[model samples]
Target: MKMKKVQEILEAHIWAGEEDLEGEVYAACGCDLMSDVLAFAKEKVLLLTGLVNPQVIRTAEMLDIRAIVFVRGKEPSKEMIEMANHKGMIILSTQEPLYMACGKLYAAGLMCESED
Candidate 1:
């Protein structure tokens, strides 16, 4: 799924890296635990999370996640935004609950790529 498409799917607000919303996302991982995201996310993934912290961005950087969708209307911290911006990750916010957000993305064809 393209970042632009994901934004549209989630009806999200882009807070940064709006220029890169056209970037493609081949996989998605929904999680609040940064540790689990780091442990399991594959390449070219979009992270759907409610954990609003700087570490979220840092974890994304390490895992090469290109986008982050904050579920349940969560707003990331300023430090998180700055970190994500510096790393060129698209940051978005949506009012949908986590399960609904994940379901929408999944139903729209964004899936978790198998890691082997």
Candidate 2:
């Protein structure tokens, strides 16, 4: 799915990297645990999390996951946004909680890929 579709599906507001909205995401992973994200995230995956921290950006960067949706209306700090901007990542925020956000994306055909 395209990042633009993910934004529309989640009713998300782009906080950064709007220019990259055309980017394609092969899968989506909704998790707040950075360790799990590091372990399971695949290339070009969209990350959905309520954990608003720089570490999330770092984790996404490490995995080359370019788009992130901050669920439950959680917003990242200015510094975090700056960090994401530097990494050329798309930062989005939505009023939907993590579960609903994930479900909406899944319903929109953004399924997660199995590690196997």
Could you give candidate 2's per-residue lDDT for residues 1-116 as a string of tens digits?
Answer: 98999998889999999999998998888898999999888887899999999999999998888889999999999999999999999999999999999888888888775533
Q: How much is 26 displaced in model 2, in angstroms?
A: 0.8
Query: How many clashing pairs does model 2 include?
Result: 0
Ten residues in a row with the worst lDDT in model 2? 107-116
Per-model TM-score on C-alpha atoms = 0.94, 0.96
Cα deviation of 78 in candidate 1 (Å)? 1.8
- Which ten-residue region of model 1 has the weakest summed lDDT? 107-116
List model 1 lDDT by residue over 2-115, tens digit each. 899999989999988999988898888889988889788888988999998888888888878879999999998888888888888899999999889988988999887553
Candidate 2 yields a Cα-based lDDT of 0.90
State each model's CA lDDT, in order.
Answer: 0.88, 0.90
TM-score of 1: 0.94
Q: Who wins the lDDT comparison?
A: 2
